[model samples]
Target: MDQFRSFDQLRTNELSVLRHGFFKLWFELTDGQFCYGKLSYGNFWKTIYILEVEKKTWIIKRKGIFKRSFLINDLDGMNLGVVTPEIWSRKIRLSMNNGFEAVYLNKKLISRTFTLTNDQFGDILNIRTELWGFKKPFKISFDLDMLKKIPELPLLALLGVNLVLIKQAKAANAAS
Candidate 1:
């Protein structure tokens, strides 16, 4: 287990989310030097994900059998937040119990870029997919000031990558 003290210690505002293996869903949040966090499957079915940041862990899983939303829960089973997708749209809303809310939406209808924004901070983070990898790695750039405002910024970044993966899976399903 990596001891991630804080994102403030990072030397750069930009980081990359890279897959761990050729066929694995595990990903690491790194700035090419220090690892800030990680995101990996919690179960074999791929319905649950384990997010680790700052030596703390959280589980992200589907809300129910018929629901499209996912729940974020602490190790003690306390619900911390929820990620809900908008109907007939490409936007996803994330709400935390601490009264924090943000929306992740594509930069354009047909683009690979996505931005995470809230009413107060506007655009806090930008995530772009790399075009040259089978794993579809992502590059994330965030505002350190805005990150200081949102304590869950790192977890949300991991969730943003999850959302992109879900969107791609849906698109592939629709095409086939």
Candidate 2:
């Protein structure tokens, strides 16, 4: 993967995701290209594998007796961060050793929390993240040629975070 441009450099306002269901999704770019991924669930573990080009790579996974959290790891298997769900609050929190922390909330009709960081490159819920959510659905399509150019980690972050969000939401809905 290429060195990521700062969060400020990417035109995040142009990013969009089309969730096919709870397990399948497509991340669409402003130029009409898409990165796709799938969520695999098991009794004691869950994993998300995203196809950056033609190869499916493990982005994040949750495994154990409780399965309360997910771990993000690099290609070398070094832990990059952790994403845990606040079951009672129905929130997904991503925390990294490097001081990045974010809280994701449920999607609303007009205010879908898609992506974007605050001025300090902080969490999406912070007051400084401009509108802090999507104004409308992104145009959905696929162009495989564009996938190689898309930075991988950012897309991983998008897929993993939203996967956690969707799981929490579904669990909350089921509880009710």
Candidate 3:
């Protein structure tokens, strides 16, 4: 995986996952995010329980109600701050996308995403994966207030979220 850094050369996945708290060091989207995770001591399933979006909303999916019959926009946030798996992802995906589309797999599942380097543009590292998929997309939702009570998360992976946010804010002002 490339430990190097550059601002101009960015990928869609990189931009999508930069603003995280758990992030320590990242190369790019192809290089899966595998820093120190606040994994539980137990040997139970350790998939990413929640995923944050746009540095604001969080989605915590239920035990079985994955994306079954829904659109990405169907996901909604809870009235309280608590994030559920159902409400955060801004489904930028399309039908027949490059992924397992047969609903849910009974066996253990893993995902590894990759990207080409700027110069060489070769597959360098394998990125993060979701242990589970949404059976029905509409099953997701969150409570906004839950965030207020929920202490800081340990799996706070940061994909340069702060840096990008600042840059975007600056660009917005410049454009305006």
Every model's TM-score: 0.94, 0.51, 0.19
lDDT for each residue of candidate 1 in 25-48, tens digit (9 for 90 to 100): 688888887788888898777899
Winner by TM-score: 1
What TM-score does prediction 3 earn?
0.19
Task: By TM-score, rank the candidates, best first.
Answer: 1, 2, 3
Arranged by lDDT, best first: 1, 2, 3
Give the Å error, residue 169, model 2: 8.2
lDDT values, one for every candidate = 0.86, 0.44, 0.24
**Top lDDT model:** 1
- Compared with the true structure, the alpha-carbon lDDT of candidate 2 equals 0.44
**Quick one: RMSD of model 1?**
1.5
Better of 2 and 3 by lDDT: 2
- For model 1, the stretches where C-alpha displacement exceeds 4 angstroms are 3-5
In candidate 2, which residue ranges exceed 4 Å CA deviation? 1-12, 18-30, 33-46, 51-58, 107-111, 114-157, 168-176
> Candidate 3, residues 1-176: lDDT per residue as tens digits?
13423222322222223222233322122113332211111113322223232223223322244532222111264322221212343211112222212111112222223211112222222223323422110111112332232222111222112222223356698999
Question: Cα lDDT of model 1 overall?
Answer: 0.86
